[model samples]
Target: MSTTNEAALSLAGVDKIYALNSRKPVHAVQALDLDVRKGEIVALLGSSGCGKTSTLRMIAGFESVTRGSITLAGRRIETLAPARRGVAMAFEGYSLYPPLTVRDNIAFALKSARINATEVDKAVKEMAALVEIESILDRYPTSISGGQQQRASLARALVRPADLYLLDEPMGQLEPRLRALLRGRLKRLLNERGMTSIFVTHDQTEANALADRVAVMEGGVLQQMANQTELKERPANLYVATFIGEPPMNVFDAKVEIGERVRFIVKDGPALDFSATAFSQAARVAIARRARAVIGVRPHDIRLGAGDNAAKVVSNQWLGDQSHLALDVAGKLMVAVAFDQVNASRGEIMRYEVSSTKLHVFDADSGEAVSHGAEAA
Candidate 1:
């Protein structure tokens, strides 16, 4: 990670509000503060209407900031025109010129910068090949497929020289295999050139595969910003804890009681009792202060076939590589994943165990994380 002095782009207290006629104003982005270091690849991840796209547009100068300051390469650019912001953006809509061929579209920026004709052609060809669009270089926008058009649009933006690059759903139109292939190539290109970039995507796989860090957004608010591992193992709050992981984290309302043994009494369910030494002093104190809390555990952490607790298997599915089991544990639904295929049938009784080391505790009222594993969060 780079220091603040080495930041390539910075946003401070940025907000975007759209006032409709005779309707309440919509807050698309809210007091967002972000920093992108030189050569760092950051992914803005969120579901639809989560403001990830709005944040990208605001940074690219395509959307006006209702409030806040944007600085790029030491210059304030919030009020600047899109063309004057030194930022290049690839739109999700494939905004290629209908009359221009793919080659011409990719070479437009170079030509506008007064590069020689030979150099422009060379650059265009290289970019087209990089994006697997070399075969469609002579085709016009209307003559190409959506995926081809998307590649051409991406090549057009990536071929340009800019201080920062913003991509909105860059490969949304490609098939799964092609998307995965391009993800590697794109990461290599960005790293080789040391280009600072921010991309918007709803796919967690894309974000995890491409970005050095991910900024998660929800309801126009920044939830958390961290690398994939941190977001998974040490999420900032309940929203991120549940949102970042696949199958999500399973949470249950519980009452904490610390004594010779630490016990979490599930609401109208079972009691998960553990040794007091399983948690650190800080974690014990935090849990003791809250009478009621939420306890979470990942599906992968639940071990089947050996424990005191009994559960009824609701459904079991073999996903070719792993087994996904839905269980009714103490009257609550819980999902567990196992690497090996189990021969258990629906309605069969099974034993499961979750160690205290795999447990996560959060505040019941605010949904804020208190501890992860045996340590304080």
Candidate 2:
């Protein structure tokens, strides 16, 4: 789906294997494929051991790829050394030299590249200002706080221009407030400078805030890659639908009947009539199978006292801007968001409805999106 000629970085059929002593080789990454376009920030997002770090390491040339190729600016570089690949990397471990001051750390790459002293100094100052570490340029690595050290590492990686930039959880160690601040600043800086960047992060907030596109990975395989809107509103599968949102999407198994009126029958719960809603042909065919299917709806899509579903309030939590209601529909627990202040008590029966367009249909057995609906949802 990406043009190699226009890409800043591309990976095809990439794999990484770790050998054990008389044991099966662990496949850390498998048949991974990705393309990061020029002047865009793409986030590699997944939980721990999901191979995000391994993928970044492979691209950076710190780890060798067992198979496949990596390309930077239309040139193959999987087998190239890190230095020859012309990629800058900032690590979570803050791999700064202990003896070097923050200013010197940032200037090292430029100096090594034979850039003049005045130019290197100017570049260091500019990078430090961009990362908000200019005041601490003289501090040693051991003298600064964890957050400062992270900024220093980022400054060093971004000080010199390169074909690509790889950042491994660069903000994972920072406080929440600082992380939020830096996310905005980093995104602005990258966009303004027209830099191509790939950052690995397990935090969905970080991905949503900073990335132009997000590649979601699980068990060494890429599940989906799309902009935040698509990933949230039209997930490729159940993993992505549930994985990308805060409070997550609520999905429940049900039996669908495509008779005179389309209906969803919850096991032991009330049946829901969706006859008024028009479904896709594929969705109709999938429903005709009458097999087990799941219905996914975002918390905001479930409205109280509005439609064809009923649930008992299990708990009510009042967040500042909204409220979270935990409901028990038959034997299953469902979460719904209420925009207004709610004073409903536990055990109270609440009637709710799901918006027709916001519904996500998936095959219950495979956990794959049956409809793969449009973005307006």
Range of the 10 consecutive residues with the lowest summed lDDT in candidate 1:
1-10
Per-residue CA lDDT of model 1 for 1-377, tens digit only, reads 33234889999999999783438999999999999888899999999999999899988887899999999999999999998999888989999999898888899888999999998988898888888988889989999999999999899899989999999999999999999999999999988888899999999999999999999999999989999999998888899998988778888999899988999988666689999999999999998899999999999999899877778899999999999999996577899999999889999998988899899999999988999997888
Candidate 1 local Cα displacement, residue 158, angstroms: 0.5
The 0-to-1 C-alpha lDDT of every candidate, in the order given, reads: 0.90, 0.86
lDDT of 1 at 267: 68
TM per candidate: 0.96, 0.95
Q: For model 2, how does the per-residue alpha-carbon lDDT over 55-129 read when each residue is reduced to its tens digit?
A: 999999999899999999888999998989989999999989999999999999999999999999999998898
**Can you tell me which runs of candidate 1 are displaced by over 4 Å?**
1-5, 20-23
- Least lDDT summed over 10 consecutive residues: which range in candidate 2? 368-377
